[model samples]
Target: MKSTVADEMCTEDLGNVLPSVYKSVRLSVASPPLLHVNASLLLLTDEALSEVFGAVVEDSEEYQTLKVLRKGGITSILFSRPHHANVLDMKMVEELTTALHSARLDPTTRLTVTAATGRVYCGGHKPGLDAASGLQLRDGLHSLVKCVLEFPKPLAALVMGPCVGVLAGLLPLYDVVLAAKGACFQTTVVESGETPCGCCTYTYPRLMGHARAAHMLLLGHELECGEAQRSGLVTEVLPTTAFHHTALSTLHPLTATPPPALSHTKQLMRQPLLNPLTSVHGSAIMTNTTQVISMARYFAAGVKRNSDNAP
Candidate 1:
């Protein structure tokens, strides 16, 4: 049903009236992201959609590409731009870095979970990588990946759908990854090319074998939930119907574990991967910068030559 409310009505009137019908969701943004009855819901019924989350979660801070939500000890970093397939643009990379940073600093935050709003969990990085934009993307991704690897608290991913592109590579790095039965995981862009994908190069090989990692990195083989779980990239394969409920239930146990034991175990587990990932990450950035800058110069020279010979 369509209910159009005036400006004053959205904040005040909606809040008072929402309790009964939308008891599970509450939205407080100036431009309400959605109302469950919102227009986008009509368009995205087939896709993985973010419900108005009030019933399932609570207390959120909205940013350009994310919603940092809190429910008790868990801080859920949600990719909020489902319409755009939740691609990792510069804005998203930066917000992810910021959210991770905040989580790292918050003493009360016992665990962190990453989930996206769309059917395509992440469509990967935004396309078109010029020198100017590419460097920002590189650095932003640098910070974001490092933040994920270095994150002291538990880092989890609830994959309700496909995770493709660079993001597909990063999944192996998360502490506990849970994928819905329908989910697929794999990278597409770096396909055997000299794509300086630093993180995945180190991560996938270590988790799975080098041969399998090579296949994943070069061939873009999609791993179904069971395959991913067997590969050890995912901790569990959850049934789609009960995924949200089961995924949340599985994580609640982590909170009950002693904080120090969790902390030390996380630290010990990540320690070995840190330095290698950093070295690989830095090398990829250097390679990409060199390629992008050289290509820029070559194109510039050709443009100048064309102008000089102009009629």
Candidate 2:
């Protein structure tokens, strides 16, 4: 049973549009900075891709590399779980937005997005050094969230491991989120000797409320899948083995909907959150930037001490 549209657009001899169905399960080495752009359904006009690559590249070194790979026709990004922010960065967000915007504008282009990752999506800490460059960092975060919020299609995130910090903070914003059974969602800032992340301050409170949020922030415990769902964070929990099929099953209808209808519906649903995401990001940029810069200095001092001790 072939999808009617897939059958028409993809070559029949290629074994039922399977070839056109790229699953971004690995990262392309060429795009070193960003892990994966969720490129399983990457479809963009050459011109549009170029413009996006150019804009985002100018803002960050990471984006520069990503731009080159995308321009070189590197399609379909599989997640390699690269070390960056626990969540998205300015450049990655911009590129994602550019891809979606182009798809929305192009009548011929259709977009289907499913975000997947390894056992651990992100288990990294943001640099405290960025705190000194608060304004700049804030701008970066602002741009990142704006893109995620504004993307015009069904966006799904597949959580396979401990989703923590910013990644956990942003999960509620996605259209659909599927977590592997036993996978945990953690907000370890308090336990790890760090202040709450910018986004964490806003999103955490909303999702778990002041009391539970305070508990997580103060104690910094990892929430199991059942707890996460009870807290209204994880939407669905599937056994590790069933995650793939279940996610696809969930996304199949989203992919099948008329592009226009999908876009319209998504936009409507997201409309309410738009103002809040923007506002939260604004405060996040300011606070997170300052925190990042300060953290960087502490990191540098620790490095220096370690070097001196070695001598």
Per-residue CA lDDT of model 2 for 100-167, tens digit only, reads 45444545434433332333454432322344543454455465456666766655666754555555
The models' CA-based lDDT, in order, is: 0.65, 0.50
Off by more than 4 A, model 1: 1-62, 191-198, 294-311
- What lDDT, from 0 to 1, does candidate 2 have? 0.50
Tell me the TM-score of each prediction against the true structure: 0.76, 0.61
Clash count for candidate 2 is 19
lDDT by residue (tens digit), candidate 1, 21-65: 122121221122222223332223212223422224323443767
TM-score, candidate 2, is: 0.61
Residue-level lDDT for 77 in candidate 1: 79
